[model samples]
Target: MYFEKIDSLNDLKKLSIEQLKILADEMREVLLLKLSSHGGHIGPNLGTVELIIAMHYVFNSPIDQFVFDVSHQSYVHKMLTGRKQSFLEARHYDDVSGFTNPDESEHDLFCIGHTSTSISLACGLMKARDLRQEKNNIVAVIGDGSLSGGEAYEGMNNVVEVGTNMIVIVNDNEMSIAENHGGIYQNLKLLRDSKGKAECNFFEALGFEYFYIENGHDMNELVTTLKKVKDVEHPVVVHVHTIKGKGFKFAEENKEMYHAGPPFDRKSGKYIYPLDNPESYPAVTAAFLMEQIKKNPKVAVLNSGTPGGFGMNAEWRKEAGSQYIDVGIAEEHAVAMASGMAKNGVVPVLNVYSTFLQRAYDQLSQDLCINENPAVILVYLASVYGMNDKTHVGIFDIVMLGNMPNIVYLAPTCVEEHFAMLKWAMTQREHPVAIRVPAKEFISSGKEDTTDYNKLNKFAVTRHGRDVAIIALGDFYTIGRDVADKLKAECNMDVTLINPKFISGLDTALLDSLKKDHKLVVTLEDGVLEGGFGQKIASYYGTSDMKVKNYGIKNSFPDRYNVEELLIENGITVEKIAEDMEKIIG
Candidate 1:
């Protein structure tokens, strides 16, 4: 087998064009096997097999630097670069991360996981190479979906300024995580239709020599074109059009669903572990938004690009109609647009993931918070239970957004509280509001939340006791409750359990009240300890007589960690917390 004969790029270089074609098919089989069992980016990786093969054949990696945007499609690159065992053998599946890691191999230049960063990163490499007078090609592989980002344009605009050797390969599979959006895609479509003869070329306008390949899957064409651009002096863009899920019939038919998913059946493409919960946060939020859209024409829901992640699927998007606006993979624009919409008497709810939301910090502070536009931002996956990838970790949002002024960052423990806070945010006109949607399982109190969210920074005293008070934020409330119960059962101590609804501001009255009876105040938050909710509490009581113990993840970028193990490492387990409290109380 061509694949069996290959161990590294050197081995791959020995194969003939006809043999390389056979190798591509072999690689797809392995990819399907690994992805079906292990789970990862299926379609993105599969579509780029031929392109990555051609790239490796044409450009000498490690010598010729390569940067992959969003790195999810780097699975094949990893396999080619002395890391095939991670995919070939199930026993070694957990050895490598899903995204590109510089530590894993020399071929991967950066540990990139986010979108629209390749061109900018490549520009840095190109600039440094020119400074050193080095004669090696610097290539950036960016997908067409990433063009919607502001940074991509900024990179394109700047890459030409250097006027040096830099190659940008645009993998146009006509998709992001979902289908493509924004105005840039129109140009891409035009270029494709006109067979690269389109007069109004976006890349050409950006001062780059542009080349388009109609069939990116053609290995001979890819190699031939890539050879021409190799070591060329000046910026160049190689636009290649290929099918997203090339080898898989089901994946090609359902591109969005197959972009990235859990383990599925190889033949039928049925998910091995399908989502069983209909009342998930995404579903619940989608239902609530639909109701709001139908009731009020002014109510609009906005997401950057990942509609499925927010539960705004095809059906929901169709139902919401124009009220649902996807700004593509542009989080910064989404925030600013929401602010403008809110200022013009339109109620805009911008739903985004916590990791992606951090990209729009400036817009959140300046456009929304500074103006106090009353724009509602629903932040999903903002807990330890969220994304585990270091680049996509959700633990930093509390610290990032919580510290911002004129923004009420609310954390809800259950569905009831979430709905109440969301409804209040939609109607309120006093300040910009952001709600951290719980990343844990759906919890229902079986009662309506009648608490007036307008009276901001109010702490809900769920269970009252003495000596020890546990103040929990968002998804960690359940853990705090368990700690309290453990203290009660094991140590026979009645511990007070408090749920702080507001993350940004403290309930001063309640804190003062707790100081009177509680000797030790423990803050539980599903985020990093530094600059987070726990630190805020600790800071608040720094000059006071009250003893504060903060529990959260330490400031570190942990990748693909087990949730339970990570919590245990951070001293967040019920037993560990209870044991510590017992000693303090004694």
Candidate 2:
């Protein structure tokens, strides 16, 4: 009744704390109902139900910017902002995106779904407010996982140094998509769990005004905290302790499973249709590699704070215990630490997102690549079609890692091939190997499924034809195959599908061969068009002789995504690619 009656944030101020708590309960029910049916970031939205309410009631929106780090938690904020209907009914394609979008509502300051970006974005907003001489409170609601990022630290340092007027709410649920990783949260946990008597505060050391709220779920406590800090001068970190997946018993119990998920049975709290193929890339790779580490004591799994998501969940963590080192959300530190481990005869497989690896570019180039540390850096979801916000697009990794002197970038088109790439990277002793496991299923390629580390130079051509060379980098390899088959069946055209296993650079011989027979070469990737593996292929073969078409993400900031739509937009659709091939040939 509370939620049905009150549809907007304005109605929030009218309700008492107890009334607001009822609304939170109703909001939680709606989130669970829709997410259990449609599926999305269930735990995150459930956790932030009251926090966003507290935020809206505390700060004036449109004027006072509320920037959320990895804005998936902003669903509650959207609901209170009068966008609940969109989430409940039209969740997939409706106006209300899971993440923050300025276009969706005036309350959303920035369209961010990636972690560790709120502080920097908030600082920018604060600077803009200063220049305009506008009176608006800029509040950044960031997770503890985000604080492990270098960008958050940079922003915090800058804000402190410059004396910017902003409120940085560290929504410390001790959880990211999986259970939260990193030293920052560890320190904060000690601080909160010990009732502020805990020593060695990272925030105070970094010159930030610190206020730790032990109870984040208590609506009254949240309101009091926010009210106390409203429009307060200078930057401050209101480290609020909250439980992720709160209210939902299953979600609360199994934090990792409920982080971000598929449609689940509401009562049973079980996934409706089991992902017949649960992503085996990360887990299998971990299983196979972690086996090697356990066999040989020198091997270690280095996590930049996402080991659980990397398939080394609590069970593995308990099994590996200290062997699977989660270096927190610090990618830079993770990379550097891996390099150090490698230098001392230890094998380190640092699994991180392709996009998040940007933070460790300098370390990768200087520390690991320069010394030729033969570590395995498992780069997951390297392509642009990643459904997360633009800030998390690891699409630029091909170009960024391409120029690295002693690094080999393996773009595995299949899940089995990803393990093969992992095995190969594990064997290399001279230089580091960065394996990119694209978002695609690995069809059974019956060829000796084992890795051939020595033959790292060779590239696999999936199929052969002459009309048009359909080049696919990683996951798009199958997409290319499907398109090529469709073209052959429909248009009386034989198309070649090339799976360039190595996206770092093109196989010159194969590229040169395509020129003579292929009428058109269409390079497809799930990354950015400007600087991607596809564009690299275009540049390599787009000489006057070859008519190469580059299909990828356009030069623009991507909005919140519909996965299928994103692929279609990037020209990754089978029908779309087949149609394009037909038109070009005709």
Candidate 3:
């Protein structure tokens, strides 16, 4: 096998044209086997096999730097590098990360997971190269989906000023997680239709020499085009139009579903562990949004690129029609646009993953919160149970949005409370509201929440007890409840359990009351302890006689960690917390 014969890029360079073509087929087979078993970016990696191969054939990597935007599509790049064993063997499947990691190989220049950063990163490399008097080519491989981000535009606008060798390969598959959106996509479509002969060129307008390859899958064409711009003295954009899910028929047909997914059956193209949960947050949210859209025309749902992440699938998007807006991969624009929508009269519900939400902190602070626009921002996967990747961890959102002024950050423990908070946020015009959507399993209180969210910072005393009080926020409430039960049964201690729904503000009266009877106050939050909800509580009782013990994930970017192990390490387990509380109480 060509794949077995080749260990590194040097071995790959030894192959003939026919041998390389055979190797491409071999690579695709390996990718499918690994992805179908391990589960990752199937469509993206499949589509980029030939493109990556051509690039590697033309340029010497580790010397000629490659920066992949988002890096989800860098699996083939990893294989071409020295990390092929990670994909070849199932036992070593997880040896390398899903994204491009500099530590994994010298070929990967940056460890990027978020979108629209390659061009800017490449620019920096190019600048440093010139300063060091180096002559290597710096290539930035960015998807058309990423082109919509403001940073990409900023990068394009500035890269021309460097006046050096920088190549930006636009992987146009007419997709950005879901379908591509925004005005720039229209230009991409125009370019695709005109087949490189279009007069109205976006890259050329930005002062970059532009080249287009209609058939990006053609290895010969790709190699020829890449060689022409290998050491070009000016900034250039090589727009390559390739199929998103090229090799797999199912993925080609259902691009969005297969963009990234769980382990699936190769023959039938079905998920091995299918998500059939009707009570899932995504499923529930979609139903709620549909009902709300039918009731109110002013109600709108906005997502940046990842519509499927928030359960806004193709059917949902079509049904919602004008009510739903996929703002491409531009989180900053989505936030600012939500603010604009809320400024008028529309109740814009912006649904974003917690990791992606951090990209628009400036917009959240200045545009949304500063203006006090009553936009409903639903933050998905804002817990330890969310994304485990360091770059995409949802643990930081509590510190990111909870500390912001004029923003009512609500954390609901169950479906009932989440629905209540959502209903309240939709109708309220007093302040901008953000709901931390529970990332854990769906739990139902079995009763409709009657709490008036308008009366903000009101802590709910779920269980009335004495001596020890456990104040939990969001997904961590279950842990607090378990801890309370453990203390009761094992230690024979009656513990007061409280749920702090509001993260941005504290219930001062409730806290003061807790200090009256409770000796030790333990705050549980499914986020970083530093600058988080737990820290806020700890700080409140710092000078007082009340002892506050905060339980949370520490201030570290943990990647692909076991949730149970991580919790135990942080002293967040029921038994550990109970034992600690008893000692503290004594």
User: Using lDDT as the measure, what is the rank order of every candidate, best first?
Assistant: 1, 3, 2
Clashing pairs in 2: 182-328, 355-394, 384-526, 384-527
Instruction: Tell me the lDDT of candidate 1.
Output: 0.92
Per-residue alpha-carbon lDDT of candidate 2 for residues 1-586, written as tens digits (9 for 90 to 100): 7777766667778988888888788889888878877778877778888888898888888677888987878888888787777656744435566677777778877767556888988999888888888777889988877787778888888888767689999888877666566557668878888866666888888877788888888889899989998887788888888888998999999887888887898788889876434446666776776688678777788877666556777777788866788766778889998998998888888888887788788999989889988888888877654545655666677668876777888877666677777776776787788887765554556565554656655556767778688877776677778887787788767778777777665678877777788878888766667876677766776445777788777766565566688776666678877787778778
Alpha carbon lDDT of residue 173, candidate 1?
93
TM-score of 3: 0.99
TM-scores vs. true structure, each candidate = 0.99, 0.88, 0.99
* CA lDDT of every candidate: 0.92, 0.77, 0.91
Worst lDDT run of 10 residues, candidate 2, spans 87-96
Query: Per-residue lDDT tens digits of candidate 3, residues 132-210?
Result: 9999999999999999899999898889999899999999999888988889988899999999888998889989999
Instruction: Report lDDT (Cα) of residue 48, candidate 2.
Output: 81
lDDT of 3 at 78: 90
Stretches of candidate 2 off by over 4 Å are 88-93, 180-182, 197-200, 275-279, 384-394, 449-456, 461-470, 479-497, 513-522, 541-544, 556-586
Clashing pairs in 3: none
In angstroms, what RMSD does candidate 1 have relative to the true structure?
A: 0.9
Question: Which pairs clash (backbone N, Cα, C closer than 3 Å) in model 1?
Answer: none
**109, model 2: CA deviation in Å?**
0.7
lDDT winner among the candidates?
1
Query: How well is each residue in 450-473 modelled by candidate 1, as lDDT tens digits?
Result: 999889888999999999999999
